[model samples]
Target chain A: MKRGWIIGGAAVIVAVFAWLLFGGLQKNVVFFLTPKELLAKGTDGVGVPVRLGGQVKPGSVKWNAQTLDLRFIVTDGAREVPVHSTGAPPQMFRDGMGVVVEGRFGTAGVFEATGLMVKHSNEYRPPKPGEEAHEKYKTLIQQSSQ
Target chain B: MKPEGQLNSSSDRLRDPSAARPPRTSIWLAFVSIGAVIVAQTYAILTSPAEGDMGHLQKIMYVHVPAAWMTFLSFFVVFAFSVRYLWQRRENDDLLAASAAEVGATFNGLTLMLGMIWGRPAWGVWWVWDARLTSTLVLFLIFVGYLALRAFTDDTQQKARWSAAVGAIGALNVPIVYMSVKWWRTLHQPPSSPATLDPRYTMGLRLNAIALLLVMIYFIRKRYEIARLERATEHMAEAAAMGGK
Candidate 1:
């Protein structure tokens, strides 16, 4: 009887913890905002960390080898926001490709990117479940669950 | 204490109730406490002042920090009880360790998810091999492996012993995971502990952290109780059948 109580008590604890951690509906739940949403929400120094999702404008990319500064324009097909970044760019960051940049709008309303992430168009399979970088997570699960 | 072979019977009956009566109100109190914490956390995340730089994404901090706290805290519980279980061979201790390990895994997984979401914009990459991030990845995987081992083993006593060992050893990585940022040249930022944040934000975050901690404890307790109940039900059924025989 005592043992049974212990087990039941433990289960309740886990469930309660999950609820407390994630059950709340925080308005800050981050979502992928479309290009239209980004444009509609004009960037007037709001400093909202936005995942500006759009295609890199074809003719707008200019790279300065000396400074390693990459200048590009992100377009929502209707409006374009100039992006200035100083960092090693990801491989997938290409012209006319979909990308998300994290940063706030500059004083001139350009989307000055502090971080850049590339998105893949291809869907992933199960044994691979898609992410090439998820191997570390899989390995951890394997060792601990063993 | 007992030989390896003799562990089977003891393991099989690990859930047998030693309690004359279950403390039912404790479970309800746990639920109410968790609910209250959720409310407080939600308010903080939604109504908190936007940052001068990150704006709304700054709010992600509320969720990110608590999830991180739960992940580490749950693992700590697992480590403590696991040691006790191994040293004293107490059934309750073993169960507590297992329960905490499972909960810890869940919270750790959530932390990773929230981190990824927060990272997409903040780091410009969905994933990175930074020291802190990589170590956390390992921690989560270890927990998953621990749970898997529990599922794989059929013999109760053997399963408990094996898992207890895993829980104890696996916890060694928690501190390593936390310190990975300091130890390695990584992109991830180190934490600003309670003493670091600006007063107002610090107070709010600390309050939320405490609320989340309580919530975590309640969940661990409830989970432990449910497992106990299930075990009791099984034992009762077994005993009734034996009487019929």
Candidate 2:
């Protein structure tokens, strides 16, 4: 009877722990927040170290080679956050690519990113025949290197 | 002089004629699996075209993904044998579970190292505290704890029972580690599958997984054999001491 009680108590404790890990502490477990979620936080989102993840807005990328300033807009369909970081992004970084940037949202309305990470999809396609794969990224690489 | 005498007797018992020798099949398996891994890796690198985005860096997937898969596979074996040990109260099952845990821990460490290598070039960071990465690290630590418990505990039956519970519980983290990306907002990409991966990369991934599976099997079998011999020697030493008393 004592053994059974001990076993029962362990099961309960494990169940509670699992629930807390997967359920009650979900917000803490999330590695990043979408722009829409961050925007929803309003003032609470500003000046706090957080990760903002979303697709890079097409045609919104502006890299200043002279100053090493990278500016891009992160969008999650509903909202967009303009991110300003000072570094060469990953080689895979491009317009419309999924990305997660770590930094604070300034009260001045730009995300002051301390870190920029490219998130690649699981797909791995080879360059099609008669098409050069490296050619497409050559300009971006050269620009970043300069 | 007394301790040295005890050690000599124990070594003699380790070479007892009654003890079973490691099977010839396990020896062949070790060589065959090692050969297969080399063949698979060479084939993968030589045949697969440069990826559209990451170029040749995509080749790292062949080793990294298979190592991670084998880590999960080994832990699953540990979980299975652990439960079996608890239910049947078999010493062999306990030994088998311990062997698998050691192999699993090895693959787990390899996976982390290879992932870091891939992450540095691909993710712009060598490590992250994301759900997937953190959970996998936790899984590795749990098994490390399981192995440590086995090493420190001298009471065979008690050690087996405690390890069985720990091993079973530790393995429960495997699925959580796998699903962490899907369940949480993480920097790590979702799990790669045939449907998600291009047709070109699938063959390489499959071959590498098979080769690694064979290697994992060979390792478990070899380790189990050594564990059995160790246990036999321990029993013999205990019997001799009791007889002397």
**Best-fitting candidate, scored by DockQ:** 2
Native A-B contact fraction in model 1: 0.06
lDDT of each: 0.67, 0.87
TM-score of each: 0.59, 0.91
What stretches of model 2 exceed 4 Å from their correct place?
Answer: A1-6, A134-141, A144-146, B1-25
Interface C-alpha RMSD per candidate, 1 decimal: 18.0, 2.0
Task: Provide the global lDDT of candidate 1 against the true structure.
Answer: 0.67
**lDDT by residue for model 1 (A1-146), tens:** 74465457556755663453356412222233445666677644347776676778988887665566888988878877788887556543556666667787666767788877654332211122233332322333343345
lDDT per residue, candidate 1, B122-224, as tens digits? 4457786555777799899999999999889866677777788778777877877776555543455567664544344565566677777877787788778
Summed over model 2, clashes come to: 0
